[model samples]
Target: MENVLSSLIPPHGGKLVYRVLQSAPGKSHLDSLAKIRLDQNKQMDLEQIAVGTYSPIEGFMGEEDFRSVINTMRLADGTVWPLPIVLDVSVETADQLAIGEVVGLSDEQDEVMALLHLEEKFCFDKEETVIKLYGTDSLDHPGVRMIYEMQPVLLGGQVDLIRGRKSETRAYELTPKQLRRLFDDRGWSSVLGFHTRNIPHKGHEFIQLKALEDENCDGLLVQPVVGKKKSGDFKPEYIIKSYEKMIENFYPREMVVLAAFSTFSRYAGPREALFTALCRKNFGCSHFIVGRDHTGVGNYYDPYASHRIFDQFPDLGLKIVKFDEIFYSKKLNQYVQGNSLFPEDENDTLRMISGTQARAMLLRGESPPVWFMRPEISSVVLDSVRSGIQVFEG
Candidate 1:
């Protein structure tokens, strides 16, 4: 059948969506919708779509929120799960979705509105219905999907809604060009992007420092994920503060740029790591530091799998700073390379701590080793936990 996107956008300009679809095939319309009901959650399956103008897509189409349609999926009981397809959007598509329009979607057959549910209520205003949609592709995320699906609306919202906040670290909005220029000016000959929700532990510090020293990269972009992380995670603002404090205290001001990555964490591990690099590349990063279990949850991915992706990255136009996992070796009494057991420190062996272990120790009112954290920061974190006030909210 003719692609549904063809009917949705200008004949000539809808080609990008067509390209995206061709690269990632969508499920049939029937299957897509069924999977939505079955999952009882919104997901971007390739099949679902929304119609709108161009300008709106640019403003409202976000990777954090996009409502698309996909194919139906089935469960063991033979229950059907319709594919949760969302409309994917980008800056260009946003403009197309909002040409001379206030609301992007149509009410009639040619431009019918897709009813989106948010917070238990249905809003007919197409502009307010964007929700997070998950898909398998690394580069395409809810933020990117929103840009793809609701760009026209978001472009409008970008001006209309001004109250919701981003953290201070990301508060200074830089044009894409300015961002590129900032990297160039800083001698960030190779920008290496690093994303995390936690404060820097020794392992993270070790690997990042190694990137600067070993890889001879010009600079590092300490981009922290400041969006919806799982519960028990640090708040974006807190993370921003932590990074700011660390940079001010430890890292050279000229060598690093601390910025907030305003996207939620998917914990997709290796794929997520690559996606992070591509996003940074979009922001002018030439290199990305991929640590062990970049975004893995529950031991699903091999630690080395995260770095192995670098092998294929040359074909993908992104470079990575791959290092063996840094860990604290109890026997050596210091951190050692994951691939080897010898102490990294020639004289004083100081084992590094893991984020997971740090969290576990903190919840129990224990101080993480100095090698794992700064004493002052760890004290503040522990005190916050003890007060029943969570310093970090995932």
Candidate 2:
């Protein structure tokens, strides 16, 4: 039998999707089709889909795929897709659109971004969608709130990006195909992917180090999600800069690389965790580290829910390295697992900071305790904030 968790990873759908249009459409072409303006988050989804970031899922999901994903965590074809990746449209827009018609997908500014080959349009049970996707329908949940605010109709189709974002040359802003090529060029067969949305704290460094060392991995990718994040989370630019500093000063030069994952956070807890890891697999990461509340928010998920969900997919085609929630133990003079020598009652000996707290500290021009955040990493955040840069999402 073959090693199902082999490091030689393949794209989720076996073949990577590349639907980028090589050139801009002609005037008549743009004028010929109906246009739908995509919000920023949806625009990011379009680009990712166009580049195989969500491989095997070439476009916004049809009703069949959406229902299958929401109810079973699988695509209609039984592919293990943890989240429903669908395009929502206003009921009026859906009414105007007809089946089999091609539509132009544009930004709010009306710049033509892509062409959606519309295959299906359907209404869904909003309450069921929220409950299934989030495990909650309470508006208190951020993901649930976003879902509740969405339009009632969904459009499903394949897309062709109009060669935009190609101007972006940063190595960190890479697509799945480009990322896989980078891993191959580095000769990394068993590279580990570490996901983050915050500036690198000592806890994060500790987790990555433990994962790298424990796994005996050939390489490590410090991939940070640089898309729309919660309000208090660090901005993408600073997150990238902090890691740039972390890798420069602390990590081995050749064994690590930093890349920005251009996908937004859904705060779907365990489901998003599984979704992110599979995305890493498409990016050629053979293994992924799931730590703490893995993509969770506001006490909505069990801390180790991400760890347990991996068991459901025996042939996940990737390996998940689960780590206990870690904190800086002053007694040990460094970061350690929660189940370490220090007991829970020893509050004075443990140091931990939430992202909201960290942001507030930066706003106050104060460096977090050196135990929780490195001076260098903290300096990057402080600089970004002090310079009037929008360092946090609002």
Candidate 3:
């Protein structure tokens, strides 16, 4: 019988999601959590769960299938705190719900799942396992009810609006080597990475420029996320247009390239930030910028945990550029670091323009403060927001 790790989830291109255990000691904040043991029986039972129960989201399994640890919940010392989570994952179509496609199982979760005794079949009301972070005793979310699974035997494979639109764009699908060559051509010895899900802000520009001017990075990779994000975020088209304008007007033409990252956003705060930096490395970037709450969601984590996590993992093979939140000061009429506020400008310190603020303002047909945005970016985003034109349309 296949274990959770080997259980085949045919939704995500047949890729089995697994965890990376045993980082060098003292490297992660997660080391203090309870350790998971690899047991053979649990592995065998996973096969049953896969065949009998796994379903795709919304009854659709795409050409690919997946089973991987969706969340990376660890503590400062590299401990695995398994949090029992209930997800009403929908396999949106029959194509995504293949016969053997497991919904929530992945090979990488074996040790942690076994450790937490999560192998039991659960009813909706059963109290699921709770795993705590290593350094702290606080348990993460609990009691997962595997409510929905797609039960389609087959699905139609056809081009949809998303695929069709993307095909029309001047998309640059690159391997690491190809991207490396582009960087190497520009004589840039190092590259600074910026992850985006919105239109570029002045603070973002300042950070990227600082990497070039101060850190002497060769180029900037304006990688944007093309995945599930919260509602009303800057559509990818807007981001692409903003970067294009930046490239055309401000940046050295060869110094920047826009790319797309096909990943979901896991607002895991610090750990997720570290994971993001590593992923940027995989794209051939030697440096990454960690901004305030980089990959953070709401009040879930410390403001500086992203940078702190990098400090814990020094050998991660990438350099991190830490920046405080950038805000616009009315007195100086420019962007300032989050930590330093102007003496005379107290009221507006809290008013620094952000994507969220800009979205609201634009939707209401208000122009953002000039200091927080470049003229072109502000105009384009506002236009898109008001006119209801998607910026990332292929």
Q: How accurate is candidate 3 locally (lDDT)?
A: 0.50
TM-scores for every candidate against the unseen true structure: 0.58, 0.92, 0.59
Better of 2 and 3 by lDDT: 2
Instruction: Show model 3 residue runs off by greater than 4 Å.
Output: 1-170, 341-351, 388-394
Output the worst ten-in-a-row residue range by lDDT, candidate 3.
Answer: 156-165
Best by TM-score: 2
Model 1 residue 327 lDDT score: 73
In every candidate, how many clashes are there? 81, 0, 49
All candidates: CA RMSD (Å): 13.9, 3.2, 14.4
Expressed as tens digits, the lDDT of each residue in 1-394 for candidate 2 is 2224444688786877888987888979898889998887888889888988888899999999999999989999988999888789998999999999999988877878999999999999999988998888888999998888989999999999995543232467887777777777777788899888788777788788888888998889988887766676776778888888888898997899888888787878999999999899888888999887888778989988888999999878888998876766666676667666445547656666456567788878888988778898898878767788777778
Candidate 1 off by > 4 Å? 1-175, 329-334, 342-352
RMSD of 1: 13.9
Which stretches of model 2 miss by more than 4 angstroms? Answer: 1-7, 165-171, 340-348, 353-356, 384-390
lDDT of predicted model 2 = 0.83
